[model samples]
Target chain A: MFKPELVNTIVDAHQGPDGLLTILHAIQEEFGFISEDAMRQIALRLNITRAEVYGVVSFYHDYRTQPVGRHVLKLCRAEACQSMGGDTNAAALLARLGVDWGGTTADGRLTVEPVYCLGLCACAPSAMLDGALHARLDAAGLENLAQEAL
Target chain B: MRIYIPCDAAAIATGADKIAAAITAEATRRGVNAHIIRNGSRGMFWLEPLVEIVTPQGRTGFGPMTVADVPGLFEAPATHPKAVGLVEEIPFFAKQQRLTFARCGVIDPLDLDDYTAHGGFAGLAHAIKLGPAGICAEVKESGLRGRGGAGFPTGIKWETVRTAPADQKYIVCNADEGDSGTFADRMMMEGDPFSLVEGMTIAGIATGATKGYVYIRSEYPHAIQTLNTVIARARQAKLLGADIMGSGYSFDMEVFVGAGAYVCGEETALLDSLEGKRGQVRAKPPIPALVGLFGKPTVINNAISLFTIPVILEKGAKHYADFGMGRSRGTMPVQIAGNVKHGGLFEVAFGITLGEIINDIAGGTATGRPVRAVQAGGPLGAYFPPHMFDTPYDYEAFTKRDGLIGHGGLVVYDDKVDMAKMARFAMEFCAHESCGKCTPCRIGSTRGMEVMDKIIAGQEPEKNIALVKDLCETMKFGSLCALGGFTPYPVLSAMTHFPEDFSKAAIKLAAE
Candidate 1:
């Protein structure tokens, strides 16, 4: 499903400043995650080493090397959320799902990740499920969200 | 009938979209013609999904509206249970000065006509008449500092880029707002994007830089989408492209999305990231003003600082400068968040006390608990206990007390918070987000966390606390950037202000 030619096209389109990050974003947008083959293809087209590409990919928290689940839930782990009992709610959700931080459920339906902030701090205890944001989540709210995602 | 509903990310998070859909369905069923416009949030977040019906007087408000309240909207808006009079009359909105966010939540963000009608491009138009030197002079006169943590004079930064001998210069708007409680950048971009487009164009004109890039954080997908749409629209309308408004000035801009890296918020690190490298901090002496972004002179400013340009140009320097106290001039869109009730963005002049902001403005803790500690600024900022609440919200005032108003965000905490755990989190966060460019930050933060863990475990508390103090000193002075430098503020502030929380005896007492 990961096409080398599509990677070439993405690399070609972003040939100027910020080309590498743009290309990686495009590749990730096309596929669920950036594979070694795709990174190699990108490096070849961009005239950079595979290690250089990997360094960038590894540096940013957004870039994933492996495929994600059907739903990716990003829970806010910042101070604002912490003040609103986000730690307890997050712990409860993770416990209910039986997955650690950055872990995917056994059913392959949900993957939970910790994000520092989403700029929705006014409504603390925020989470983003598959790009749509949910906020003001208590323990029960987080549980119901995880259950729905699972 | 015309209806206004916020499409802001915060509003959407709290089910604004569902309420909008419910209102539409209910209106259709009743055979009533209703027009729904997705506006930006008014910063009164507690009352979000704050539905407004256009009345003869003004936009009459009703919210935090639910789907249950939708049917009543059409029946009798005046008698609706959620009705809260006119939107402008709300105390939270009416009390403060709203310059930077003047058009936000007021106009349809994408509509150029709507933007123009709301006095959007007047600054850019005025900048064309003033010329580059005059524009710089006006900014210098205004005394506007960076709304980002540093509080550097914006005029001087532009003057550097303006005079620097470079055939090709650049204007970069730092929209990578990574601060936890801050959302002014996101709100402005999502709400009134053209203001940024216009402001950046003004910066380009003032600094003699034709090319601009708004480096936005990828977490704000909606803001990115909104900015991109506005950029394309501005281009099509001849506002951004060559010979903008036929003034013989050609300036254009693009949105560059940043991957999730907290250090990328730093100007030098941001430049490195922009160049497709690891976002490591570049040492100073040939600061980004001189050898920046592909070895050319560049003017980098925070999104808020740049967005405020138009108003300064339109109203003149003194008018904008007169609002604030001391060296800190102009209004800051202070984001009050976390455990507080009525938590939202309040754009007020500097010198308002933190006590007023938390207790009076924010209405204290949402859980009805006593306010314990409040973190002024981002993760890197120092924590202020309630006793220190009288300190005015000025740059010098906060810095005098060992805190910085980094990005104008205040994350409040209730009495239930454990200061020791919060202190550990500061070190942990710094270690997690460190760029690994310098040893003091990279290694010191990890060591600090470990020492904190030891202190928490009641294992040689006095020795570990001393070690942490030493580690903090190294990180504070020796680190490459603010990420490591300011991490000590919260840790030391906690230890000093809430000593009982850090003591093993207190922990034992609490347990018993």
Candidate 2:
């Protein structure tokens, strides 16, 4: 399932001083997560060491080493959301799902992670399910989102 | 019939897309000639999916609509339960001055014709005549400060970049809007993206930089998508490529999506990230203006700062300078959010008091409770107690109180909030997002969080609070960037303003 040729193509497509971030994004876009083999191929193609590649990848919170579930739900844990009972709602969702932060559901249908902010403070307690944003989430609304994801 | 619907992410989050689809189907079923335009948000988020229809009077508004309300759009709109009269006359919208966001929620984001028709490129056209020095002087005269966090003058920054000798200079727009209660940059990017493009282009012309990059966060996928589309369209229209608008000025930009690092919002860290490295903070000896972006001169500005440039150029520096109080000239698109009624973006001149904004304009807390405190600026900004509500929304005014108006974001909290927990979270956030280049921020944040936890657990409250103060002092001065330096604001502010919350009895009360 891991394609080495695709990594080469991705690295070649983004060839410059500022191509690493773009290349990593593309690889993740294609493979869901960056594999070790993919990392090796990226280092070789970009004339950097595997450690350097790993450093860059590991430094950013967005880059993932392992695959996510069918759907990824990023819940806001910042001050704005926290003010509007985000902590309580988030705790309720986590308890119901039997998972913690960055945990995947038992059925592997959904993964819940904490994001700082999605810039939707006006409608506090926001979340992004597979890139589409949802706002003003109550405990029921969060549960509904979990159900939808599952 | 013309219908206006917001394509802003906030609007979309509240089911704007579904509302649009329902309206489309209903119009088709009714055989009414319907032309739907997906415009940007007007910043009145409470009335999101705020639909508007062209009337002889003006664009009459209706909103917070649902799919169920679609059929009624075809009927007599006058009797529609959601109708809120003319869009421009709405009190929330009418009260403030809208300079940078004038075209937002008004024009189709990607339509070049619509953008120019709303006086879009007139600023760039004037900038071409002003030449480099004139442009820089105008910006300096306008007294426009960095809308990012630092209140540094935009003109001085441009002048430094312009004078710096470089074979290949660059313009970087810092769109990494990681602040919690801020969405002005995101709204502008999603709504009036061309203004940003035009602004950056003007910067390039002023500073002799041909290439630019908008470093956007991955969280803002809609902003990235909108900017990419607008960039492509601008290139096709010959507004971005070489010899833009026959002005013989060559400037083009691309959107670079940031992987999710909050510290990347820092300029040096952002430059390093742009260069494909771990977003560690570089020292400020050389600074970004003279030596930046692969050792070349770079003019890195916040998206709002750059977006505001066009208006200053078009209307002249004095016009913008005359608006604000003291050194803080021009208007700020102050983002009012979190637990507050009438939460939205209010772009106004810089002299309004915090009490006026929180009480009168925002109509107080959404929970109908008494206002406890407001964290002006972002997470890094200090928390202001109700007693300090008279503090004006100016840079110096905030700084006088040992606070900052960073990014012009105010996250209001009701009386139900526990200050101790909020303080601990700030330390936790810093630890989570720290770039790990320095020792104080790297280790102090974790230690700070642990100490706060111990205090919360009723284990030696006085000593732990004192220790937190000491650690905050170290972090405030020792850390490399604001990420470490400013973490103390929230921690100390909470400890200073709400001393009762940090007590052992209060912890027991909270637990009970």
Candidate 3:
């Protein structure tokens, strides 16, 4: 549900090959997701095919087409995290929350997603809630973090 | 009094921002005249939210701080329960040979004067006098290699870009630190943004590249924000942009954010992403040095590689060449992470052995269990058993052991770790992040996963292990980029080092 004025505003701020990434980032920043309407409009303005826009949106993990919940919790599920019981901790957190990977809570307050890494491997089992990274996470810490988001 | 609190993402994640705010509020209410400096992390991650008070003895450290610790901090800073003594004197920090990261935790990242006061722009200022070939020769003599895992000589890469005839050349810094255990790039960007700026500026002068681009990953929002802020500040101060330092040579840089593709860390793929395309690998022969970033001659380097330039220029090539073992010269900002007791950044000369890093610098496993293995480099690096701990950290040394010093990310694993699952995770990671441009990587990684699943399931174990080995070999030589080529390192290393874990009777699979 991107407005025509927002599309015009985004397009006006950038130029050339760099414009696509800049525009996509601007739209994502303004709204949580890049909707089909937004993608179509981007293709129209940038003079590219709609298929190309969708290809980009689907290719990158960060470019989500659907709207996420109020708070996003990205748990690092990479090797470093795995070395420190991140998998077990994540499974327990998910079980307690009663949601699967990429699922939002029934209250619409929180969404849980799996990220490869947050670059906080030193303090393994790292997580990012609303883009703020948390380190040395445990089951209790995860619960507290979830509660804070609520 | 001046108090320093890290505003880096890791610190903010652990409530450093809240602690900073609480300290400000409490200090004002208590009539304490204190100036707060939001600096970068000292790379000692565990003690983060690490508060430091400027004292006669230097910055006294206190941390793993919280909002609740603020009032107590003001009451008795030195004797507080969290106080860990001077930041510099801490055994973890005192031993580091931090050439590139020297100013990270020491200065306000955005303050140009502070940066300059602590030897900022000295490299750029030095490069301005050397001209192009002279600067390239200096870098060649420094014996620096790419810190982005490839270990290519930095001087040769610059010389190729310098000698190449092009109307418009470009300098590209690969800040896509997608490896699981790596954060050195993030630390450098967040802690000392100006060093990168200065280093990149030096590249522009050396290679005759008037424009530069830093392709940072989307995961590092804090790093992106810091780099952007400092870039603008440097421009205003004329350390960047038109006629820098009145040298009549012009250079400018912009930060380009990548949407989350592991392959983008590869130079060619990064160049493609910068051009607003899906991040995919490009074949090389006419390497990125001769033709990169919009088809002009480009000097592509990792964040650490470029960040090392300023110090090289400032201190002279011989000074930097003096450190480290043969061939693999200079200090590596080794990121010791995973299930380790002293997990943090330890920048040291390249000759140190793995045993010293794990047992000495990192202090072994955080779980207090005996360390079973360690994965040096990134996801693509081979896992090393305790028996191989004597291997040095030099690039050639690691290569000799069928390992790599990729990005110098060392992830320690305790005895509790299941090698079967670790191997599977490697394949799963490759499958998830593969660009699908190449057949062996795209298909072989998936096939490898299935084979690993069967081996862990105790289904035709001998046959499955052989099949997995075959798949790995195919992916090793048949794939397009490092993503496909290096995935074998982890899988094969796991199989070789911990064969019992993959035995038919072991049957250890990760809980799905």
Candidate 4:
């Protein structure tokens, strides 16, 4: 729920902050993701429509309109990662988790999202579980890491 | 005082942590006044584990260090020390025209005062006085182009978005620098997170948008951490909140980590991924200006493009614009990668020939072999032979010679490189990275790969060669985005310049 005062504050807040990315991030943090109420509040506050607010939320990959899991499992899919079998490792992990990217596990313990490079070129096939790095991973290594999460 | 050590993945791969640990243990053993702070790298990668002592002058350097060398540092072991000598006089640091990269490796990345002391907020301070239109005009006059490959005029893009009527506007910085043999963006973000923040803020002011996003590749974990730490500090300082500098200008940014997709480096594709889509390229009639990031006016600039804006605004336009030759105005941060000695970041002005950079600055191949083809930009960039080594490094000149000045990444190959294999790699890269947006790119890339396979196999080699050419031509004209369009440059350039390599396959096939 977004308060009228918060809406006015957020709208007043929107003028100089680029568009609404920071507001959306804040809102997402507060409510787990961008809510219809938050969008409407932003629209009313900024003198725009709900569609406008929703549009901003949906445009950038950073903004989440839906709730993610407790821990985010981000797999590296950049070129160097691919050269080290990132695709195969990702597929094997996905099969074990039984969910596609942006999909959280049934127990809500983990969410798998595909990520680009983690900048570990020399040590390839890397992944980030939550915010920590795991490098030079084979499929078995990733599954072992995934089991720890389970 | 805490001695900063970079264990960022790049530095770790090069053994930064072990040296840092060794230094700490050595310092404790000697009961000296030193503690190690595992900081992000300064981006001068050639100097890994580049230890800096807090001298009264500044942070001093001694580098490419190992754990064995750490204990020796206390007793003065650097064959070439940074602090003892004029730190600024080092040829690597001295030769660079670091506008965007000005503060990198010079200060504590998390300290706001450290940033300000090193001339960090001067641009933001100056920009606040001039207003949005004034900032845009200054950038326009500077003739600063996008440094993240395309080299389009940054000022013009800012002006268009500044003037464009919008209910909402956005500034999206593309930090997805997937091009191989390039590390400037990563190095900058890790070394000088504040500069990028300052640069993005300047863009936000110029574009009249209240929000910004940095779509950094997930590969840059150290950069991400440094940025996150810096953003928190900036928010606390009221520099990035509701009213920046009490100027009624509000611009805040959040970093969005990208899933692996080289195609996402393209502006439209980046926009799509930002919107939580599949990172696919879109047709540009709506051209991110009129309709971008949620179908609103958006200023999508590369990391280096945004990074250059603060300096352009702080210093006058003419002062900034007076750096380079015609049309290719301002400095280019050339990234020297792959099989070259003295390989690292070399930010120089335009009009410098390939030979001067590669042969003189880089000192030729690392393998002690005569250099053959030099690939500028990245894998998608054209490979030039020894004859074209004198070509000037600029957008117009590169285009004139049927090549590109993409992202300033120059990957050198020795005489041992098979140009034919290199050509096949271009096709293979396109096939793998294509977003499957258009037939010519998606379908044609696979065909191109198959055709290259046939030639490599010597199966109807002549027919395969013609097919590859035809496919490249079709992909050039017919692809929806640059993924297919520019793939031909590497393919055809190899075909024309390295005729003997491709022809040998046919001759070998005839003999069979």
Fnat across every predicted model, in order: 0.83, 0.88, 0.78, 0.08
Q: Which of 1 and 2 is ahead in DockQ?
A: 2
Tell me, by DockQ, which candidate is best: 2
Q: For residues B1-512, could you state the per-residue lDDT of candidate 1 as single tens digits?
A: 99989989999999999999998999899999999998899999889878889999999999899999999988888899999999999999999899999999998888899999989899889999999999999999998999988999999999999999999999999999998989999999999999999999999999889999999999999999999999999999999989999999989999999999999999999999999888889999698889899889999999999999999998899999998999999999999999999999999999999999999999999889999999999999999999999999999999999999999999999999999999999999998889999999999999999999889888778888999999989999999889999999999999999988889554695598
Candidate order by DockQ, decreasing, is 2, 1, 3, 4
- Candidate 4's residue-wise lDDT over B431-478, tens digit each? 878888799999998888888878877778777889999998999999
TM-score of model 3 relative to the true fold? 0.97
10 residues in a row with least lDDT, candidate 1 chain A: A141-150
Clashes of 1: 0
lDDT of 2 by residue, A1-150 (tens): 689998999998999999999999999999999999999999999889999999999999999999889999999999999989998999988998899998899899999999999999999989999988999898889889888988
Flag regions of model 1 displaced more than 4 Å.
B504-512
**lDDT of model 3 at residue B192?**
93
The residue-by-residue lDDT of candidate 2 on B379-483, one tens digit each, is: 999999999999988999999998999998999999999999999999999999999999899999999999999888878888889999999999999999999
DockQ for candidate 2: 0.92
Error of 1 at B53 (Å): 0.9
TM-score of chain B of 2: 0.99
